[model samples]
Target: MTATTPPAVSMLAPARPRRPRAARVLLAAACAAVFLWPVVMVAVGAFRTSLPGTPGGWTVTKLVDTYLSPVTYQVLAQTVFFAVSVTVVSTLLALFFAWVVARTDTPLRRLVTPMMGLVLAMPPLFFAISWGMLGNQRVGLLNTVYQWLTGAGHGFFNVESWFGLILVSSLKAASFSYFLLLGPFLTMDRSLEEASLTAGAGRARTFFRVQLPLLTPAISGAAFLTMLAFLEAFDIPEIIGIPAGIRVLPTQIYSHINATYGGQYAEASSLAMCLMLIILALVAVRARLLGGREFTTVSGKSYRLERWKLGRARWLGTGGILGYGLLALVLPLAQLYLGSLQSLFGRYDGFSLDNYAAVLDDAEITGAIRDTALLAVLGGLVTVVVCTGLAAVLRTRGGLAERLVTISVWMPMALPGIVLGLGIMWSFLSVPGLNQLYATIWILLVGLFIGAVPVGMRAAEGALAQIPRDLEEAARIGGASRVRAFAGVVVPLIVPSLLSGWLLVAIMISGNLAIPVLLASPTSQTVSVEVLKLYQSGEISQAAAVFCVISTAMAAVGVVVGVVRAVLSRRTLLRGTG
Candidate 1:
């Protein structure tokens, strides 16, 4: 008898080959191309003397000229200066707080820990307005307080400088690093510290040698993420730096797109392209540096974490958290209230609720807030859905889908907001019959979805992979189809993760400045864009109030979502075990 495979076995293999690999590849590519359409357009426009009318007939001379500009060189120098300052300050601050919470026996670690995460969710515009309310030379509330305290004159505190920009960005951005470092510090094996102690190493020495080395991957990742944030910052630099005559690449790009002289689309496109290239280089360097490090901070091994007794320093840690929180959170909101109560800002004679009334009265104010909320919720939901699909494709074995999704995550992240906006304008707005989206709020929504999908998808994909395959198999054995098994068994398991992704996208969309700045029509402005308008027009108090409302609303939503999620999770676990 011939040793050939059975006809039934061969038939089974071809009938339903896993996921139709080609379809998966095609979906991944189509998704990637949708995201990349803007990026490709930007590259072409950046090199052309004028915006490209045809995709095939673009020129590279604009990019060449952009490199030759002395202003471009200066912008590069300023960008590096601000980025380095923010990185150093944020990393050190994050490291200090992380150590206090994770290693020391502090009185309020639980409260402080989640608060740090909350701070991380605050939009940069809020940070800028808060600082502006307290530090701006002409209208600073804190300057008034300082004069009262020290008998000093007003206009002494200038927030529109390079130092001010760096400090503000760092203070706000540090919370991300703190969140990143907290888990690693909590999960690290305490035995390493004990071994170092046995070798006669002191607490400080053990930290430098044993603990820091193990936390290297986490630190590197946190720093790189913060660096990217500092690099791409827009609203803070726009509001504060413009007044101070300090400009970074993002603000510079904004100027080219929206400032007085009919838009300098070519120069803006060039700057955006340069920013993307710089981001790519930084990410590449980080990946290379972290390649050799072991990233297994949380393994299956369980070890009791030893907490250091911080008897006296406990108060110090508590005080530090309180002070940072007040600086970033409390003080800003207070200043906003004081500012918004004034009928005419900078006038001490009259105190009234006219500013708040005025805010309610303005048609633009109401419209912007409504638009911002609707777009944020819609964009967040779409991001969660699309990202889940992308993540699923990525979790499977090596193939075109996996490779494309991985590349998509890293690539668009490098694309600057201004450049992405410009690309969208070209591909969707400039094209014949496509400019209709530009008229509707949907254009901004599309930009928000594209901007945040990669982030949401990555988070969802990671969460989805942790679900045990046995659950799905058991469902399948009960006569369920693959789709049914996923729907019945997998969806419920990953809902919490899905919600987290949605919350992130919502926060991002609410805080987003670039796309809305470029895409929002007068009728479709967002709160961030309104705040920017007020900032640009030098209406400090009104801007501060708007900033406070938007930021505070986001933080409140985050708290509500977190609480509901916790309650739901407990009920779910109880039901599963029952």
Candidate 2:
């Protein structure tokens, strides 16, 4: 018995290997610096009495002065008002459409999902431009049509007003909420509704008590996101608000930066800081609201989804869905295409191919097209790679390093693109050797990368969550190095999601104007910036033409990606079965 003192160590026992803590700490610190450097630069600028390029002394006078201005409060109030209005309208419309398509047996239900993708692919900037062409009071297609049908002396529509701004913004915002809410709507437990019905609740009452309550988290989350979107929105406010004498925080910041006699950098920085604080507050509130409870509906248990039958009202539901498509998608695109064919200011003298011809012939337009394509591809690749790495590390690790990395990746979500652009500009210009990147395409790439990485991280995290850790563990246990195990076991499983995330980021980058406006140099201009210049310079049809080309390209890409995804999925299913 005394000789049995030492037992043989089992080779199968789990190993508590010490990971490289120093490497993780360094990586997290680097990522945090990348994410927060611009923000810190912006804060420095906001507090400085002078601009970065000039001699500056640190002070809070700018911040105090901005707060003391009455116009600041007015703009803040209007921003809140616009954001709240858009959120409410978008959320209600999204709920209705999500319910109609996901819960009810609506006609063309198969088309609803793809159509929503198409709607989302069309950028909000394009929507603003299209609506501007459709409702410009004087030469707008809608106004022209209204005048023709009713024989009115004056046009009946004006997109430059608050009503028009809210309507267009709400329509765009609704598409996002629709996509976000659709998943939850489809996956929610039908047993809850059934139980309510059995307990003497009518259909409508059951929906309100059982179905809607279960969807509260989804609804609230979508609303908060939509609100932030509207708050940070630059295209809509810049395009529609300026002409209507409407000023929101984003547009106001734009005005400050683009003011005559070389813009006020300090003031712009102060405004950006204020906007950042507001967004941070909103984000904090959202986290607080969602932190306390679990909202998952799907589980290991098998459950059947029971689609509601609307009887004859199903046709009405179908009609409602089609109507939304008509308004949100078909109508604006049609107006854009038709308007692009018309002369400048959408003159109805006769349609011509001149706008398209000009777009093709213009060197700047061609250059912008090429530049946009490059930016989309390169920026998207970089974002995906960085985000995937960060996500993988965070998922596998724990403690302070992991937490730091998580916080760093998420910091961009609270910073608007405009603020990001401004901060990046300041950051590059402030440094000694780095100042060379200030006006180059690299700056724009950096800005877009920061803006898009957060989304990619979220997408990657969702994909990684579906994969089991045991696969990697098994490979490790089989004498495989950690790198080899990750490459062989993890990469293949997550490729589809990574590809999807990359495509999404590319599409978004191609359409983004906010970041480009503040960062792009003359030679580095993108299509969105070109479109804005054309519109601002009153080249209406040409702007429409450029927008039409870009939108068509994006739509075609969406279609191709969808088809490819379908084919790959089918092949995968076949392989599994075989």
Candidate 3:
């Protein structure tokens, strides 16, 4: 009988790569220049101590001034409070909901994950604008209904308060945390829980003593990452906190650049550096906390957990899921729809298509829409290509330089949007010939591209990691070029995941408010920036209309892409079948 090669043996066979060393070096250099250099430029820009367009010598004066200011201390303390509270509240909420879905016999459990995904996909800018309308104290839907029900003269609720800021932020944060924790819950082994129950422990005691400890690592990791996200949050804070006189690091940096008359480029750079340092320290602590402590539930082999029979509590679980969907997704979107049909923001008696028509007819809104579309497509594709190329290069190439380049490509994970935007702006301005690039649409493109690198890189790397090098080796041995080998053998294996990731990246770029706020000029403004301008310009009803248009478009694209991805993911080739 003819002997066939064992799968493991074939996978471990030595292989020669056809890719040229010079080409690899050049590609690595290009990636570093695009994805890595701008980060270093952030620190370099902080010490420039000059106006953005004007040339000047480097100095530490601005950095020293920002570091010594008492107001900086106040902002720091408040930011910590806000970040910590949001983290705790969001984590607890996600843990509870995730448990209801993953551990218990929650009715309609499958619906929970998808709904949360939708919530996570909905941009914070959309919520900030929606809630700004829903809780306006004067004519907000909530307050309007409240006064009618209670027979009060004035509405009591205001979204522009500490309570509102945290509420809005926590809702967004919880959706993300739920997804992060869901995988852990799903993968957990049931032996410990089974043992605890057999020993006559109550469910509560078992959860607290046995299961919760197993989940502590995931919970802690989620908390730190969530804290970092909100630390540089701008939309909710800018819309809600500023009216309450709340100053977080992100908003403070924005004020220095855009809110001030002439703009303080030097001060903005200094503040960006400070926030950068703070996030770096947090990231370091998080790394230390998680190092060598990735708690795996499966001991030796994987086992399944039977969903607890919750008896009558299953309906209660379903109710909780419905409640989250109502508040997080349904209510705000409902308010936005209702508000969009009105000619005036708060008036409810009469409705019109005038706002929609006007928005569609306006040259500026149309321009912004066109610009947003161009950027989302161009930026998303560029990010995916560059990141995909980097992932492939890392898999085959080995050197200290390549590893350093790899780190640089992934370093944007710790960066907040406005900080990175400021860095890019300063980086552009610091060079003489490139100063003109700052005022054009191209700068926003670069900012958006880099803003997406960390996520895109991770997605690409994860996809590439799953694919065996053996397939590519076989292709190379058949006389295929390295590029041809990858294109022929590896791309098909990971295309669905890559396409799914690319779609999400495109949506994110479409609705991105923070980066565009810093980098966009009047002519280059995107749909998201237009929404803010409309709202802030006292054109609330029109702003709602704009959001409705964009959200509807994005949602349709998301649904279609999701379906295509699902179909593509079903290919048997992905599973080593036909």
Candidate 4:
């Protein structure tokens, strides 16, 4: 009998065979084509004289026309000013809240942590519509209260103005910045603060001289990130800025592409080029200078965090924290819920379920709800899988190849939502084979996956990084193939982070408006798109009704996910002990 060789088992990673090998190759190509190609196409579209779908040679005429226009400079100035204002105010607020939560013995501080997360997840459209109705000059809730209480003839606030725009966007920026800074604050060693205190510094003095300085890098990075976010902000800008006659770059892009007739796709592409120039510069500073460089005071050794005594001041700090929670989340949600019940906004006619009935009974709206739910759950899973695969592939390589992979994974960071949507739309329309996917739900799915890669990968990398490389190597040494080792060893270890990341992606996808606004067909309409249409068409109460349903569902899903994670964790512990 012929001697039979052992079946394949320990194939090296780069030469892995059959299904796993094909998957790795397909994923890598998809990562490149999805993230990198669209931006390149945007650049191509900028110079191409033809509109998005037609054939034409490249030229600089559109680019020059865009730059030469006075409106271009005006929009640029306003965008910079708006972004800077939000960044500064939000960063300061985030810093204060982060400190309050991490170092001080403030009452109910632990609760503030989750409050910020919920605020961060709540859609920008939620804030925009809720605040819009609340701050309406004529027949708004706030105005009605003001008139009743203060005997004022007219309400002072108009949400269609710059002040309203800044307030809504700043609240969101602060919540997100606080979330990013919180992790660093919680993990930071307190040795420097202790040393400063022992060296005759008062608590206030130590906080400024030591703690603040130690946190400078993290704070600066958060500030920059916040600026980048406000730059790309679409839902708030479109809902508020457009009505105010304010033109941020994103709104400009939207207006151009959705203009009269066939629209100025080329002009919009040129505008996108301008926005991308700024974002790409910021992304370089963030990814290259700060990426992977730990700015923490110390790491790898556990240190007890000594909480600062608040004396009689705990109540003040706690109240402040709770007040922000109320403002950031509770107020908007309450106003939204109230609006949904109101027969008409600003009137105290007996509450009715009329608006909810109208929203829920609409065929289009029901379809949108189903689409949003599917995209959030299924699109979120697909994105997590793609990102996790990319992370796994990169972990096996080093130097230039890994750097290229890193850059590709984060490519979405350099493109604003409107711009990316434009690119993806134009890309699908331009490419022959891809044209088949255009105007379909699948296109929006692609956008969500690519849009979510940066976030999903960060969570995956953090979880994966915590595991020792030797553990995977041990599995390999025991004759497991790379695929088996990764599946059996790595995935089980990172389940919690994977699930957390998956939830984040889902929340983002459900709330995301810009990408879907550009990409969705009537059949593929998402809740966000429908919400915008409802709000725009003066169905104010109906819009609120739609949003309230989505918000409640998201909260329920989040709670279920938290319970599952907790149960899985407990079972793992129990099994290990047994």
Candidate 5:
């Protein structure tokens, strides 16, 4: 009877940590205070006729009146129209291409995959600028090419309108949705389809009846994200939409704050509130759709590798993939490279290195690039560390505090960048001594940091969830302290995830446009803002050169990182066996 004693439980486990828990609570509260304080001040100021101590009367009634005005409604409608169009168009395009590459044995998939990644690395504004350079009404480079080729007239390149804006936005954003859906396509269980086929169903019928049903989550998620992306778009629409008399919520807010309207902070705040509400509603719907139950199509069991015979259709599908890759990646990048080499617009008299020389020679341009690189490197490292810390704490704490922190990190992701930047500006500028940072490069970094945190946290959280808790328990039982256990065991285990998180944050920070535009000064201009400015001034050649340099450099860096990651992963796998 005395032979079988149950496993001893440690009654003297770590005390319910009062100091650590209280400090975490206080830190979270303080961070929240810093983040939301600006929006609160703007909200209050938005209602008042002027600053509280100014001569005019102060009242919340003004906010109501401003929102109800006819002009606001018109702008709101235009914003919604553009966003919806972009979302629908982009989602469809992404779905078609994803199916082509994932379901069928499409040709050049390896090449197409890397190209999509490259395009994703470029900011949205870059596409608008590239298109503008080649398609603007009077001096578009593509129109010039057409004239040279087919003797076509000048009226063909009319990207200065709403149609052009929508097309460019949708095309540029489609890459991300394509990437999102690829995951589902790769992991989907083939047996489900085989079962339908074995039951005498046709291939197309089985696809529609079985495969598509399992992919609903991925489809829904991509559409939701695309909608958010289109809704919050600023740089592309601002650059192209203005010429077509099209105004979205972001540009309207910009006009309210920066245009000759004498700085209507109150009205702008009200508009921002409206934008926040719309985004929140979308986020809520998306969360509800993606919430319950895992959608794991792949399970560890017997299976069959099913492939459809494309025959003649195979080449056509392959051609489509190649065409998209060329249009979306090759052509644009080629234009950028060629434009960078020529010193002046359409002056192919001779090639000169002056454009690149000028970009490098200017102290301001050099400084901005340096600042951008520094921010990307530092911000990426910091964001990954924070994300890993939060993910670790959440695994251990699993309470109200964990839930609150998780939600707080995602809050910034839901708010548009312009909205968040405006809130930060309003909140910090109103403070006594903090306004000095408003006009500096630091502001740009802070805004990017806010944007970076949410995505980084999500990536790290996904990786952490894959790890088993037994690893940590085993370490603790071996006499390791909590911090030591995490550092020695958890950190090494999640290195691949940490590196991935770092890469994502870096790419995002490198291409960020909205936050940098609002935060950077004339002297502290980033490459993205510079490209927009050059495009606006009809300096197509210069803009193209700048873009080429940046993109090429980034692509090279990405290759290095990818190789390192592959090596590290292999090493880890080998060591685990040993």
Candidate 6:
């Protein structure tokens, strides 16, 4: 009789909900629209007869006319050459320094790490301005010092030349590659190199035959990323190349946008399309090189990093590193600090606090400081949240949907900031209701959000990959909903990574000039834009003063982040020990 009744159903049984495919699809589409709409608008504008504000229809006149021009070809060629030169030099320099620091017992190796961090902390625009001040032929501090030491009538170094441009750009580019390569160099399996050495290979042979071959993936990846970075970079070429009468694609696009008589927005869009195509081609090649290969260097095993003892040559390595720091960090910072105190840029005409006082007192500068703070904080927060969600979906849901989301999020990394700015300008101005935001700080925030999402997403994805899904699943099994499980188990674990991504985006937005330059109204001006304007107007002392303020603020933020990181790391260590 009891068996015939069929046991009472248990109301506490766990329920497994199906994945929300439609919602994920909708999210993917929404993200794609947010990220890709601007670029699509630029493409549409490029073929149009006039700018967004003007009355015109679609036409290929601008594209055909631009392609037919000889200057366009020249500029394109120069841009490729410049990018390639910087990539090669920077990658090689980074490889050398990374090797010295990670593999060898180089003196001051620990110091070199923090020095590189400082170098990265300094903005590229700041580098451009500082070097411009230091290497000016007439009144540059470096030139003056060189003249003083060598008794030369004319200055030996001119930052306005192509050589100077390449040097500064390579220095900046090297920092990026250095950071990228350092991780690989540090965690690489020493067993492979040891095997090579045990098999009768000398040190050089081991490096070339075994070590370098194993690192081909990292090296090539770094090189390609550096190339992409150089192609998108506008600060170096804009500040140094303009004065030297040297034109590249990015600078050419900028010139078209800022022409005396109302400028050519359509033409700028056309040029941006060309630049975008070139970048797409590079990306295709990079993809082909990276695909269908196993570049894994680590496994589920413990390993020790064998550091080479370079007793005598340690000093030589130390000297080379310090020399690089002198050029890349010490010299520029020293010049910037000294320039800030001077009444004039090059002349140390009896140092005074006047420039700092003037810069601090200016309403525009003060406003810029406040606006940049808001942009950094708000933009960074929005980007981190959005990118974290996108990354989580992409990581957990691997399929066509995930791939689409990944591509959409990363698309902005390929576009130059100025190009992105131009696209946003067109997108907002062409839209009926969105046009109201064209000159507002909101546009800048949105543009920066788009620009920074890739970085934040990548960081988040890496952090998420390290965490196990079992933790969330266990919570789900213990009668918790999916969202509750994720919130309770995942977010707390990834807080450090989230903080890192936020800090990175904040730093990037604070220093970014290209996005703000075109999008900002007078009321929305940022420190980067103001610094550029001041430098362009020949107010070198005032610009230097502003740069000092910005740099100091950035350094303070960096210090705070460093301290927090250290504290968190100690806590993590204690937890591990306990």
Cα displacement (Å) at residue 268, model 6: 1.3
For model 1, how does the per-residue alpha-carbon lDDT over 120-230 read when each residue is reduced to its tens digit? 776777778778767867667767777778887665777778777777788887888888888888888787788799999998999998888878888888888778877
Give a tens-digit lDDT track for model 3, residues 235-293.
88888888889999999998989755678767777778878888989888878877886
Any idea what lDDT model 1 has? 0.78
lDDT of 6 by residue, 373-419 (tens): 99999999998888777776776668777777888888999999989
Per-model TM-score on C-alpha atoms = 0.90, 0.93, 0.93, 0.91, 0.91, 0.93
lDDT of 2 by residue, 1-578 (tens): 46655654455735746678889889988988889888998888887766666677887777888989999999999999999999999999889889888788888877777777778778878899988888889878778888899999889878899999999999888889999999998898777777789999999999887777778889998998898888889999999988999999988988988988788788889889889889888878888877888766664555668899989989987887788788788889888888788876757778899999999999999999999999998999899888877887887768898898888888888788898889988888888888878778888888899899888898888888988998888898887877788888787767777778889999889989999999988888999999999999998789889987877787688688778777766765675479
lDDT of 5 by residue, 82-167 (tens): 98898888888788777777777766656667777777877777777777666667556667777778876664768878778888
Candidate 5's C-alpha lDDT? 0.77
lDDT by residue for model 4 over 1-578, one digit each (tens)?
99998767544434434345555566657667878899989888888877777777888888899999999999999999899999988998898888888889988988877888777877898788888888888877777788899998999788888888888888888988998788778877887777787899998898787777777778988898888888988988888888899899999998998889888888898889999999878867777866676555765655767788889998998888878877678878888998999987776778999998998889999999998899989988988887787788788765454566787889897678888898898889898898988878889898887887788898788878977888887887777998899999888878877899999889889888989999999888999999999999998999999988887787789899999988877876675579
In model 3, how large is the Cα lDDT of residue 159?
Answer: 88
- TM-score of model 5 vs. true structure: 0.91
Question: Who wins the lDDT comparison?
Answer: 6
Question: lDDT scores for all predictions?
Answer: 0.78, 0.85, 0.85, 0.84, 0.77, 0.86
In candidate 4, stretches whose alpha carbon ends up further than 4 angstroms from where it belongs are 1-29, 188-191, 197-202, 284-296, 299-304, 312-315
Model 4 quality (TM-score): 0.91
Name the candidate, 3 or 5, with the larger lDDT value: 3
Q: Could you tell which candidate, 2 or 4, scores higher by lDDT?
A: 2
- Which scores higher on lDDT, 3 or 6? 6
Q: Model 2, which residues run further than 4 Å from truth?
A: 1-10, 13-17, 294-302, 555-578
**RMSD (CA, Å), each prediction:** 3.6, 2.7, 3.4, 4.8, 3.0, 3.4
